[model samples]
Target: MTNHWAHPTAIIDEGASIGEGTKVWHFSHISPKTIIGEQCSLGQNVYVASNVTIGNSVKIQNNVSVYEGVILEDFVFCGPSMVFTNVRTPRSAFPRNTSEDYRPTVVKRGASIGANATVVCGVTIGEWAFVAAGAVVNRDVPAYSLVAGVPAKGMGWVCECGSTLTFRDQKSVCHDCDREYERNQDIVRKTKDV
Candidate 1:
C-alpha cells in the first residue's frame, strides 16, 4: 500500500481510514471513523466529520466542510467553500444527539457541486449531476441533470462527458462526445449502443 500524504498541520484522527495515494493538505481535520478512498485530494483547511465516506479520486477544494453522514461516491468534485449540512433542523437548545436525527447526504459518482453551493441534508445528488456555483440544493437531483438557482431546479440535462445536451425532436446529442440521448419524462437516457 502506498503512503498517503498528510501535511504536518493536518490532523488525521485515530481510526480514520485514509486510502493509499490520498493527499490531505494544509490544516485539514479528518475525524475518526471517516473513510477516505484512494487518490483523493483534500485541499487546504478541509474538515471531514466522522461517519463521512469519501470515495476514490474525489477532489475536495479548500475550506469545504463535509459534515457527518455524508457519502461521496468516486470521482466526486466538491468545489471551494461548499457547505454540507447533516442536520435538517438545528437549534442551540435542542441538540441532535443521536444518529437517527442526522440526515444522510449522498453525492453520487462523477457529480460536481460548484463553488460555495449549499447542499441540504437527506438529499441524493445523482451520478454525473452538475450543480452550479452558489446554488442551494434542497431536493434530490437526477443523474446527468444540470441544476441552478436557489432551491435548485433542473435547467437542462448534461452528458456524461459534462457537456450540455442539445435536443432535436426529443433526441439530444452531446456536443463534445457525439453521444446520443433520448428524453423520457424529463429524464435523459443514453441511446448509443455501448
Candidate 2:
C-alpha cells in the first residue's frame, strides 16, 4: 500500500486494487475493479481493463493492453506490446454478451510471454510455459513447453530455468538445470529420476 508507485500521468480509476510495492508508470490506465498484486510493474502506456487479475511479481511491459477476463498468475512476465484477446471472434457491429462468447485467458505461474506475441482467448497457458516472440497462440499450451510460430506449435520443451531441452532417444535433459523431462505426445512432464 505505502510502497506502491503511480506516475502522475497514470490514471488509476476508483475501485482498482493495487498491492504494495507495485508500480504504475506514465500513461498507464488501471480500470475499475482490476486487481494487481504486490511487486508488479505496469509499464508506460499499459492498460489493464476491469475484471482483470494480475498476480504478485508480474511484470507487464510497455504498450501492452490486458483486457477483461485475463488472469495472470504469480511471477508471470508479459513482454512489451504483447496482445491478449478476450473474445475469440469479435465484431464491432455485432456484440455478444453471453458468457461463452467472452473466453478467459489464464497465464499460469512463472509463464513468460515474449514480446509482440498474441494469445487468443480460451487458452490456458500452463505453468512455466514460454511463448516466443511474435507467436500467435490459439490453443492450450502445456507446462514447460516452448512454443513459437504463427498459430503457435510446440517446437520443443523448456526447463524451469528457461533453457531448451536437448533430446536423446525420447528423453531430454535441461542443460542449465540438469533436470530430466519425459516427452509424451507433444507434452513434456518433469521426471523425478533425473
Q: Which runs in model 2 stand beyond 4 Å of their true positions?
A: 97-100, 192-194
**lDDT per residue, candidate 2, 82-149, as tens digits?**
99999987998999666457899999999999999999999999988999999999999999889999
Worst 10 residues of 2 by lDDT: 185-194
Error of 2 at 177 (Å): 2.5
* Residue-wise C-alpha lDDT for candidate 1, range 1-194, written one tens digit per residue: 43899999999999999999999999999999999999999999999999899999999999999998899999999999999999998998999967789999999999999999999999999988999999999999998899999989999988888889878888987778888899887677788823
- Number of clashing pairs, model 1? 0
Q: Local distance difference test, per candidate?
A: 0.93, 0.91
lDDT of 2: 0.91
What's the lDDT for residue 93 in model 2? Answer: 95
**Alpha-carbon deviation at 194 in model 1, angstroms:** 7.8
In model 1, state the lDDT of residue 74.
98
